[model samples]
Target chain A: MAKRTGQVRAITLKQVAEAAGVHASTVSRALNPATRSMVVPEVVDRVLAAANALGYRPNLLAAGLRTGRSHLIGALVPDIANTVFSPILSGASDRLASDGYSIVVADVGTNPARHLELANQLVARRIDGFILATVSRDDPVVDFCLDQHLPAVLVNRAEERRRISAVVSDDALGMQLAVDHLVELGHARIGHLAGPETISTGFLRRKGFYDALEVHGLPAGDYPCEAAAAYNREEGAKAARRLLDAAPGITAIVAANDLLALGAYDVAAERGLSVPGDLSIVGHNDMPLVDMVAPPLTTVRISHREIGRAAADLLLQQLTGGESSTRNVVLAPALIVRGSTAPPRAQSRLRNQQRGAG
Target chain B: MAKRTGQVRAITLKQVAEAAGVHASTVSRALNPATRSMVVPEVVDRVLAAANALGYRPNLLAAGLRTGRSHLIGALVPDIANTVFSPILSGASDRLASDGYSIVVADVGTNPARHLELANQLVARRIDGFILATVSRDDPVVDFCLDQHLPAVLVNRAEERRRISAVVSDDALGMQLAVDHLVELGHARIGHLAGPETISTGFLRRKGFYDALEVHGLPAGDYPCEAAAAYNREEGAKAARRLLDAAPGITAIVAANDLLALGAYDVAAERGLSVPGDLSIVGHNDMPLVDMVAPPLTTVRISHREIGRAAADLLLQQLTGGESSTRNVVLAPALIVRGSTAPPRAQSRLRNQQRGAG
Candidate 1:
């Protein structure tokens, strides 16, 4: 039953023992750092030499059974193809690597059941903890982790209840910055391209949009807002089209994500309208290459890498017998004004008309 | 020695047995799918219900020790933040998931020693096989895998020896496409921004550039060429600056990557040279957002996702006891024509002069 599959078998302790003319137990003692001191120095040298010659790699899985620490962390992302998640994964993986932890990333998509199944599989491998970047407002996986007493931390998204630790950017403040920039640019009739309501970013950013409108003494109900089915370009394009058709006078739009903002760019092109000339747009999560886009995007730059590192830190705290309190680390968001946003067309026209009269 | 880490203890088999009023061995037999028939039907039902109520998860590590099938695959990438690798990972992971195999991806930068260390760590965890995207033209990790008789497959980049199966884009064909497009636009003086020669893409593409020049009856050595230290924007900028400085008559430039092309765009902007009007550019690897650059990039499009799927398929073959022969899968690349390419300034000026005379 202990036989390995496939044709390749790794060099065993017995083989090292035969080559060194020592007992198999002596080879094992020589290999283990803690037990190496008990073996005679001459025998230990011979066993190590034999093991090195044969390319005998120690089985960490077997060692983990005795130590009860696999030192492997499981990370789950909603979409691996999304540029936004990659930096976050890189940050978390880099931080964990320094601490001698290896991350096994699973692109679990948006299915909750699949998320739980993948989580269970990772748990079966005896992972130390989880750093999940795939969580909705009210997630079943969160509940599963809590029920099983597993150590897990959320990144980029948080659960409705504060049952576990999480590290996320301030969603409401991100929307506020976008809206404030648009209002200052004299955009009165502003529309919104919202994300899915099931996720925290979508739900909170939508609420924040209306909240910002109210703060500016504008009627929130007068503006048109459409929610995309998902955080993707196609869904964003669909929602953008619906918003554009529904609100013809809108001169600006604030999207919940960079992909949705790019979707708005697609819609603007389809309608033969120039960005910032006919419509000003702003995006969230200033992902890579947004600065190089035609009319570089005016976006809310959230430090995704920092968020990932913070999440890893929280998980590490729990894994290392540190603090166990449910702490939510909310990072700040900054507005990066680029070419995609400008003063409204009517205001610019009036200024030009005034200049002509002068 | 088997006590778990941290403060949380999992629901044990003995706990399930106590809840079901049965012996621990009986509970284990009832829980295992292979041995469930050995237990009475009523007792099996009781044990399952008890296990479900207690949230008892079977220890897969322990089971794997007995069966020798972990069903886990290890994958290595150079950089996760680079958008090119994301689609490949997404494709490979999606394919492997269907076969009940989960992939653990490590971003092993470009250091051969680090790559070897990470591979050895994954091997220690008893990964069934490896899918390597970090191999160079003559990679040490490739040699290590071969010496250990490990089942490993290469993706995106292949080793010079072809000791293992690999899936890569036809890099030479990609260069030919870029050069042909520029030549068709009447660009007689073309410069090249070559990638590092340590990589297969860099070496093959540079060779292909000269091959295409000869095919088109153009002198290869007459043109300027500079190789970047790495496939990054900063290095590309340094290389592009050198090429532009060395060749004043060059009207068109072909870059090995989109980032290098964008770096050329930066240099053009710095020198107040307009794209296509002063200098025409062609790039390779039509990564995300390339089409949205100020003057959308004209580049070679590699089906990275297909390359990833093919690589996974090859690894699956080796893992499942299929073909042991080494095979190379070369995917064809296509040219995506956009706004960055045009006729040379001299030819356009000559045409304008002729029109003026008419």
Candidate 2:
């Protein structure tokens, strides 16, 4: 008679082995696909049939203990809801899935005080590796990962001098794309709405603005700049207003990101100034729905998906090789020209007047 | 010499007991904070000191095996990048965190063919409960959960007859709000852009629209309605164009979601029609940045965060009680009036003519 234990208690290997007329150790070897080849084909078939009849389930915890690897990865994002991080997360997740790894994501939210604590919790759960998207220039979590000899990769941002492995967009090139586009439109005076200086993207993009202006033979001092406290719409609006007030003569505004440029639009509306007619605006990170906004955003498009895939690949390489290598991958950024940017009004007027004079 | 072996091998309770001059069982009781009161103070101090010196870490897996619970919850989202899902996710995550439970989120993406496979994988990892944000009117996952007797709760959408517990917004009330606001503005001939009918939101909102029109003594057949295959900008634009072409007399359009309303804005621009002057538009789910878009979307605001919290709370209740209850919670929706909605041009014309005649 078949013992009907139901599913209250999971069917154990002993039960399956007994039903198969084999030892428990033999059943274990037969159940494992890697070791099944060593077992007789007839014995393996008997073990599988008995296991299926008994509804035997292998415990992942026991497998993990034997292998010393959980095949699980953790991804820590500052805000999971933030539109910028989701694409990167999906890209990384898909890449990791292809390598037979599952990800557990932790949303750190706005307060990063719990970053190290959360990482430690995942470590305690025996997560094999981590992909950190919530990195500052100097982060305690990065130090912890290094000290613990854990496989980790930084995505979207890197520490100072590329001290760790990271996959990030070329922020300087992104800024240059915005600057050169505005410069080509014949704008002599352009204002920069910089992002928070504590992060890599903010710092590099701000520096790139100056370098791009210098490359075009324009005086950096003529371009007014204001640093936003965060990469948000509210912060962008405040920084944009400050820049607008500081340099009223500036014909075009180059924002550090699309949200900041959207803030520039609000300031433009408040001052009763028309876009391209009185001022032109340029943004970075051509995120979703940017094209649908009022005048549509003209910005630098960063391939965040590619960055995510590269970050995952780097982490997997470190995990498989059993050595941490510091390799920084920089992705290219392209300018997506849209309705938000046009030739400066003063330049257009000067050209029209010159035509009249001619 | 003190054994300086690092985190490679986890220190067991037997070692701690040997160092503390106590039995392994005594060390176990002393280590557990809940049972520490039963142990003598001196023995507890010795066990703690020995544990600290040996760098002992509790094995959650072993503890879970003994307790028959894993304290881990799985959250399955349709598209993690979808803005609508983020707030709900954060809400559920935060609520779960309060109960000392951690979540592993899986982004199933658009193709839900692998939903059951992912759930089964999580089951193998011993996830205690699930908060499903992806549920159709007749879902196979819900049936599986019932058959397996797993603790599960649905969020954002529900199945027919409320057979399973769910936390959802009042779709009918949301539609009523959009319909009433437009009717109050004297829009006699309104158009509807419906969402895909497979989901509950799409079906319920469409039904609500007709019911609200009937309540307002308006003819449902008089209002032209077009269904969008998906709630996206491109689909919204197509549906809006179809409605516009089908019923040129329709003075206003009410979209099922904010993204769809954004598409309406595009179609309006394409036709060289000015918003609020030529036509009024209303949307649902006042999502992030809807206020900043062009003429600002006037829509129904559903508290997705509250729904997420409620779903988590319900799942936690079931987990702690070890029984599933069929309790469906429907949150209320409110109307947010913005720049997008106004009196119909025909109504404005009639008023102006009346004033001129008077």
Candidate 3:
């Protein structure tokens, strides 16, 4: 058998399409879930039948022998356990699965070096495309994925240099919705428990809150903003305390994430203040349990599942010989008004302090 | 290449091992991650180097062609995004990864019949083993997976008839702990919101709670138990209300799962009852957000991750032919004391109810 030495007689997807009497790209699309719907069912069946008859099963290594194309797509995720990334993995996997291609994912962990090793393994596996959910400013992985001429898509993040295909919700819109919901409750002065500036979601959402105030024609002061070290609640609590201390006149706090909102809720109670009555609050991400909270926090809802599906769609496009142009898929966000926010108190300490009595 | 027909030269793992100057089993162990560490580093290095140099990449498919053993395992899960399954998937995958095996998982929806098609695909793929997490009391998949002579393992659920290779937490011990904690809190008339009896966790945990109370010499009349339709929050709320009506004097409530616990919280709020003060509540499955809730949940902390890892360990044993007989793994549960349960109200509500009746 010549050791089956990872070599095969060269055959092209184009020939399969031609044999099936379909466009070459149509065969490509038919093999992919994202574009499969665009092809007629009969045509898809014919193309798949022809491919099977030809024994054209995706042989990643043997393809490495044929056209030197591995056809393996790679997905990188920060945390697979998080609800947000579940759909992304499912979406990308499903899309790639249809096209006789498979996805290999690398976990982004507390250990950055581990991620590098995982990336190298995927590269060694000869991944021809990549989807990165943990893109940071000036990421080396991004450079490596791109330098190899591997089609790459980013989820929830964009490189500082721009021009990367990304599927991210408008953090600015998310923050604006939260701010507007609080302001509609008659909060005169609002503060923001912002996430870290290091992350795109944090940086954009914080700026979005300030921009929202200006858009709503309100005078904004620098005291209303406090950035946390990270998106987690411990950082949220620290940032919330600083926000309240710096802006004692603030009637409501809009947390960049639900965990941060929870932190603010705790700090509010520890200081002998009652939520909604003493101070109103809104959180972002609409994460689970926020609705079950004591006052049922008001927040913005982003489609986590949609984000996943879209990211996968973008990756499949690149895999199927589609344009290499960078596409930005910005999903919309909406406000969910619950019982958390209320009007400023009649004996408003914040209002009195803002009148120059502080 | 003789058309690379179905019949091809067979290279037994035995030959590969002998060629590498090692025992056949050691070669098998060297290729498997679980047993890789057991092989000395020098021997492993030699084996791997020799195998690569000889182009001795054992064809997983070719092995199935000869022995009808695909060396593939199939895992079925209810919800991939659920926090509980994350650890389980990772644990199982990590265990299988070492053995040069991959576990293919499919999401089982409301109608389990959908699993039939997915299972057929796995069979066509010639999967040698099955690891299932969503087994009901009378699962047809059980007879199917077993009849195929395919080694199968169940997690979180067990078959009613036999000792299958299953991994589950000691739910009875978990119930005892909940009951003991509530008793320590001085609750006399307690209510239990149980999960669906259609699943093993539901049926056993409910029985355990009753058995635990009996062991404590508490009369069955002192407790009112209502089984939820499902473990989800809505069913939990329904079960909680049933418990409240069945035992109006109930001072404490023990729920089967965290979602049911959250539902009980909603019912308590609706009745204008204060948690821990008027209606102490205890829950199982320390799922995410329980800690973030207004009053953190007091529940049994079962290691979802550990369960996953344990299941993986069990499957690897089967895959590597280490354990020929079927076995079940039972994990211990820890009780996490949180803010949800407190001493029965000083005013004594159950005593007051007795007095009013008198």
Instruction: Report fnat for all candidates as fractions from 0 to 1.
Output: 0.66, 0.32, 0.15
User: Global CA lDDT of candidate 2, please?
Assistant: 0.81
Provide the clashing-pair count of each candidate structure. 0, 0, 8
- What would the per-residue lDDT of candidate 3 be over residues B1-358, giving only the tens digit for each residue? 3321111233467777888898878987788787899999999988887677654545444344455454556777776667677567667766665655555556564567866655655555456677888746777788776655567788987666655688889989999999999888788778889888887788898898999898889987787899999978999998898888888888898898999999998887777677877788888989877886768899999887777778878877766655757777889899999899999886655544455456
The candidates, ranked best first by DockQ, are 1, 2, 3
Candidate RMSDs in Å, in order, are 5.4, 5.1, 9.5
TM-scores of all predicted structures = 0.86, 0.91, 0.76
Instruction: List, for all models, the DockQ compared with the true complex.
Output: 0.53, 0.36, 0.14
Candidate 1 TM-score versus the reference:
0.86
Candidate 1, true inter-chain contacts retained: 0.66
Docking class of 3: incorrect
What lDDT does the true structure give each of the candidates?
A: 0.85, 0.81, 0.74
- At residue B226, give the lDDT of candidate 1: 95
Count of clashing pairs, candidate 2: 0
Q: Each candidate's iRMS in angstroms?
A: 2.3, 3.4, 10.2
Pick out the ten consecutive residues of candidate 1 chain B with the lowest summed lDDT.
B347-356
Better of 1 and 3 by DockQ: 1
